[model samples]
Target: MTTTHEISADCKACGSCVEICPNRILQKDAAGKVFFRPDRLWMCFRCGQCMSICPSRAVMIPGLSYETDFYPQPALDERAFDAFETLAANRRAGRSFQDRPVPRELLEKLVEVIALAPPSFPPVKTELTVVADPALMHRSLGLMIDLYDNLVKKMANPVARFFIRRQAGRETFITLNNHVIPLLKERLPDLKSGKEDTLTRRAPAMILFHSDRQSENYRTDIAIAMTYAILAAPALGLAGTIIDLIPPAVEKSPALRALFQIPAGSEVVGAVILGFPKRRFLRGIRRPLKSVTWL
Candidate 1:
């Protein structure tokens, strides 16, 4: 059927599409024209090479036919590319945020830009929990602290620790008990009485990403979208940091999960806290890649 391919009479058989075919699924007939063989129709991937390269715009794909669906983005020149590198290098894990909350309009615009970012083919979607309100985030952080406190008490007991180790594996439980729990406990007073103000590090906003249980590539999808989200933030004069500390606790405790507003039947896979940074970084130190094995 014509479901997967369509070429209007506007096609000039210029071979632009033919040259760009990644799968080589399209082949020439005796007329020196391009057509996908019937057997190879099953292999057709909607990568949109044909549509993108077609000079006449004769080629069409579902959901990509509209004029607004495609646009010409010029390649970054040397100066633009250098600016990109600089922004990337200077990207900081901003734990300390200014007391001012991110403007709702700015957050809305950021989300709008991220919505246009690509996901994998048949991409799994993620649900975002945006804690934009300073008051709301404060309340939620308090609740999260309470839930984590209860978990620490349970994990501290020798009998409880043994069962947890058995269930969550020894190294995992040990890390929770030895490292994560103690740190939270030390900060518990500051968290509880609101004295220290470093509980969630004074972030004015937090964005939590969660995936539905049914998606097979939940983590991958969440991570890819998260990369887009964090990258987009710095461009708007905002900053973001990937959050690993919260998800582990949220995954383990139902109350914590609920406190973070993780939807039922979905799990928090990735998260980030975002806000205006207190101070900008002038230069960034490099962390070189260690293991390189080129075949």
Candidate 2:
């Protein structure tokens, strides 16, 4: 456990550290020196809010487990809000993509911005890895398809289906029979022709977000971070969609995890496939909410 964070000699005693501490662990003594209750160290969120809000760069938090070198900028004005709203309205889930690859620098910039995804709990950090190589992307998708194909094959056996249905429940059969198999069969001709990988959308790039799954808020953190990344994509001249299929497959198979080079104890919670869209949308569509409440 990192026990001590520093307050430098340059401290202006502005009390920002005391005010912004999420855990309320920092305090100012009668001498106006910032100090902390050592017993409350366990509650520190390590959010670096104190260091950020300080007018003097004196509160040096070396004891925190995360990054603190970042500086905030003013990005939320009316014009910025309107621009974001337009971006949100125009956002599309780009199923089909152009053949061109995303530039490395641009993709890196998107990853940097999306790294701002918030941690819902103490220390669950979401990591983003971009699979920008077309060859590697196709091979990885092929490996996932192989897993599904093997599953589809095994489920074809009466004995295997009997055991699987008993062990995994009826939804496995329902998903395979109704959804998975039909879609695969429908794309058979396309698969044979090598015209496309209908499943992956064969996007020029893929982003995989991996995180520890022990916490109850794990999935929520993943969702929030992924949502932020998705909303931020259109502005970066890219398009993406939330991929629900691959994560389940990865969760079920260690081989799939190894194929993507995910960390040993971590799991893939969010996957986004990004690329330039092949076609442009003429207008934004609407989806009205069903219900609301006021008290």
Candidate 3:
């Protein structure tokens, strides 16, 4: 499937589509009717702005339907900003979860939000896998713990450390050495002894966001989708947290590959565990970025 747009005779000559096109491929003729430039056709990334803003529904993009894709947008209340601020301010990393599994309906709602996430490109290249079964999640958690334990052990060897650093790059090796290794070393005994779970936090459900390794901007695409899911969770009566360890572990483990049905040459870019939160915070914490500069 490739991108193509068609303008119908019903075009109202409003000039809205021409102005809205990102690539400026849509133009106005001397008659003020909107037409696509043939030479500039290659620049059209199919963002659908023209079709979306057309009042007469005259603009059509392949794989999209005016009737189905466009809906009556509801007006936001004056308090909408307050509501959004409250939602954003209250979001916290949910590390502990209740024993029960997250409802399928709620998970589907998160998926819907994920669907709305803007792709880095016109067609979304990312994929999501929901592990909703409690037993399956538990098994996956065990595998991840095992994988990290092995990683800690492997990083302890000079030869292994040297090879890993060379292969994974300096920044990646620094992250593993300074952050991941210490955290795993401290948690591995407890993790194996069933004392506590610092990994998935025993959440009853998890979603893996992944894509083909060769896909352009797949990492950012998956990150955006995962962010949408986590942000949408509290509204659906669920808690969510992004787990950084899962993706790397998934990439390395043949067992995890089979479990998640991750195809060859694809990468798991992000993962998040979701469930009813084990506890609630009385107050939200303030976390500002280290630096901000205005140009």
Model 1 Cα shift for residue 91 (angstroms): 0.8
Model 2 C-alpha RMSD vs. true structure (Å) is 3.2
Candidate number of the best TM-score: 3
Model 2 scores a C-alpha lDDT of 0.77
C-alpha TM-scores of all predictions: 0.84, 0.85, 0.95
**Candidate whose lDDT is highest:** 3
> Which pairs of residues collide in candidate 3?
none
State residue 233's C-alpha deviation in candidate 2, in Å. 1.5
Please report, in order, the local distance difference test score of every candidate based on alpha carbons: 0.76, 0.77, 0.87
RMSD of candidate 3 to the truth, in angstroms, is: 1.8
How well is each residue in 243-290 modelled by candidate 3, as lDDT tens digits?
A: 898899999999998999988889998999899998988898888999
> What is the per-residue lDDT of model 1 for residues 1-295, given as tens digits with 9 covering 90 to 100?
2355766778788878777877776777799777766677566557777777888987766556638656775677779877877668767888878899999887887777656655554433777887788887777677677777877797868888778789988787778878888888898877888787555677888788887887777788778777877877888788988877767667777766766678788888877888999888877887889987899
Provide the RMSD of all predictions against the true structure, rounded to 1 decimal: 3.0, 3.2, 1.8
State the lDDT at 44 in candidate 3. Answer: 75
Q: State the lDDT of candidate 2 residue by residue for 4-119, as single tens digits.
A: 67777888888988998988888898898988767786787777787778777777665553344555656676698789789899788989889989899878888777767777
Instruction: Rank candidates by lDDT, best first.
Output: 3, 2, 1
Backbone clashes in model 1, listed as residue pairs: none
How accurate locally is residue 219 in candidate 3, as Cα lDDT from 0 to 100? 93
Evaluated against the true structure, the overall lDDT of model 1 is 0.76
